[model samples]
Target: MRARRTPEPYLWLLFSGGGVVAALLLPVLVLIFGVLAPLGVIEPPPAARVRALLDPLLVRLALAAVVGLCLFHAAHRIRFTVEEMTRGGRLDVVLAPLCYGAALTGTVIAVLVLF
Candidate 1:
């Protein structure tokens, strides 16, 4: 099955949305978790406090959306990059599913874990 043809538009939409979401969220996430939290600029909260922050349904849903979209973005980029490097569009069949399926799987996992 040609995964690209059936879902071309939707995939592109998701790719773009994911890029935007990742661009906006990733740096902040890194700054908080990777830099400030480690450097003691912002204290890392206790596990209970983290749990409390994630206790809300709305927050969980938003985080799931962000994770899903970012996964989609990465899948799109990797799929195309592979195809381009091979100098043929022939791999789109395998690449689309392999990439997007992984993204979908990750999204499902995020939803499961978050909710």
Candidate 2:
């Protein structure tokens, strides 16, 4: 018998990684930028300071990863949900690529915008 290879492991890895990144960082970002800064619970940094903070290439790469991973996390969740709803029928074949493709597209766009 020959060993069979599948892409499932890689997809699952991305899903797990994205989940960790989203759980660890998304809430903090949302709380700080979305809630605190907007409500003035914390003063927002000046535009120049924000620009300077994001000026470095490393910072941009980090931001891109966060954004891209979050997108992949969402895509994974949605793909499974859709598959379950469809009872893992033929629709799965269609949904898999669509969901992941959207994530990949968003990641590419983020890379372009960030870089």
Q: All predictions: root-mean-square deviation over Cα? A: 3.1, 2.1
Q: Pairs clashing in candidate 1?
A: none
Q: Rate the local accuracy (lDDT) of all candidates.
A: 0.93, 0.89
TM-score per candidate: 0.87, 0.88
Error of 2 at 38 (Å): 1.8
Q: Where in model 1 is the C-alpha error above 4 Å?
A: 1-5, 39-41
Model 2 Cα lDDT, one tens digit per residue, 5-98: 9788888888899999999998989998899999999989889988998999999999999888888889988988888886885787889899
**Model 1 lDDT on a 0 to 1 scale:** 0.93
Candidate 1 residue-wise lDDT, 1-115, digit = tens: 6555467789999999999999989998999889999899988877899899899999999999999999999999999998999896998888889999999999999999997
* Residue 49, model 1: Cα distance from true site in angstroms: 1.7
